[model samples]
Target: MANDPIQQFEISKILPLEALGTDISFTNSSLFMVLTVGVSAAFLIMTTSGRGLIPSRLQSISEMCYEFVADLLRSSAGSEGMKFFPLVFSLFVFILMANLFGMFPYFFTVTSHIIVTAALALLVIGLVLVYGFWKNGFGFLKLFVPSGVPAVLIPLIVLIEVMSFISRPISLSVRLFANVLAGHITLKVFAGFIPMLSKLGFVGVVGALLPLGFTVALTALEFLVAFLQAYVFAILTCMYLNDAIHPSH
Candidate 1:
């Protein structure tokens, strides 16, 4: 039914393609992902192309994004983390744009799918692992062994740290995927009520006011959530990168 809130997440293939016995079709989700990348890249490139001293509104936004992610990285990982600014910044922009795009009717939310968020989470963690070992060598193992602890509990602590490190991607991906999925579903469910009640003439229309109010409020909240989730993901990425940079610290 048109009122089905969960239907918003449906992924349909736009162009059917197959290769090596695998379905590699272009999908609505894929389109939105591409659109998100294209739009964000274009906006940032064009807005900052002028390099104006007195920045235009678009340029100001672009600058703000750059500075915001930079500050977030520096705060979590210190000056050393600036080297990963491009990765963190791209992630923040991509997630923020993908989330905002979903606000439009009929647009698919790429991050709403666990597969997408999981891949991002894995990428961050993968980098952390590769860099941590490469930079520190076996000294990277120091990450799981805290500096101060009783000898008896050292093994236990290491095990705990190892598990916690292993769970990073799972937590990161679920946090983003779940928040986006729930928020959109709730917004759609409430929004569906607006038209349903209106069909019942004046009395029903009057009754629809409650859900209408809820829908409006939810829309506002979802926008905030979209930004917050991006920030949270980026900050966590910085923290993980910090461990890679200074595993023993």
Candidate 2:
């Protein structure tokens, strides 16, 4: 089981619960999600609790994260979009923490699962739809209608725009899930080689060096992908929200 890459993703029930006919068991995925939220909240709270003339390392990190998400929202959605800072910031931190936690041995990667990522993507898209309609009413439909197009081509353009809009959740969720899933699987494959080669002979032990080197490099790359995926998800959310805020454009 230790050598099985797919085994790491298996969700085991921690506390089984059922309501009527539905199974609502707490799972490994659930545990990690709760941990991610708690850790993210604690980090932000601890870092910002104390205000001083000179910032501490934790304070600096928290501030930088705040500014980073704020800047992303500002650039993508404009100053008006700062209203959604809490939502965007929370998503960014939760995903970033979940991805980083998965790097540790035996830790479950929540974002690697399509169910988790899809839920998040749907939440963002749902908000966009709800707020878009509430803010713009029927004008929200204008998002599918471009500002300038020949009358003959308007119908085809609207159809394409509608399809693209509908695909946001799938693309957003798959991008994060696929990258994390593939990276972890590749790391596990190389890691498994290290022990297998060492078991062969002295020459085999020396040959293990190549896999070890690749594993190290891949681990570093996964860390960057972790941060980048979170940023991409958050920024894309902002862009979608911008459309909701200004559908005509």
| Pairs with steric clashes in candidate 1 | none
* Whole-model alpha-carbon lDDT for candidate 1: 0.96
Error of 1 at 198 (Å): 3.0
lDDT per residue for candidate 1 within 1-249, as digits (tens), equals 988988989999999999999999999999999999999999999999999999999999999999999999999999998999999999999999999999888889999999999999999999999999999999999999999889999999999999999999999999999999999999999899999999999999999999999998999999999999999999999999999999985
Which stretch of 10 consecutive residues in model 1 shows the poorest summed lDDT?
Answer: 102-111
Summed backbone clashes in each candidate are 0, 0
Q: Which one is best on TM-score?
A: 2
- Give the range of the ten consecutive residues with the poorest summed lDDT in model 2: 46-55
Q: Per-residue lDDT of 21-119 in model 2, one digit per residue for the tens?
A: 998999999999999999989989988899755889999999999999999999999998999999999999999999999999899999989998999
For all candidates in order, the CA lDDT equals 0.96, 0.95
Candidate 1: regions farther than 4 A off: none
**TM-scores vs. true structure, each candidate:** 0.96, 0.97
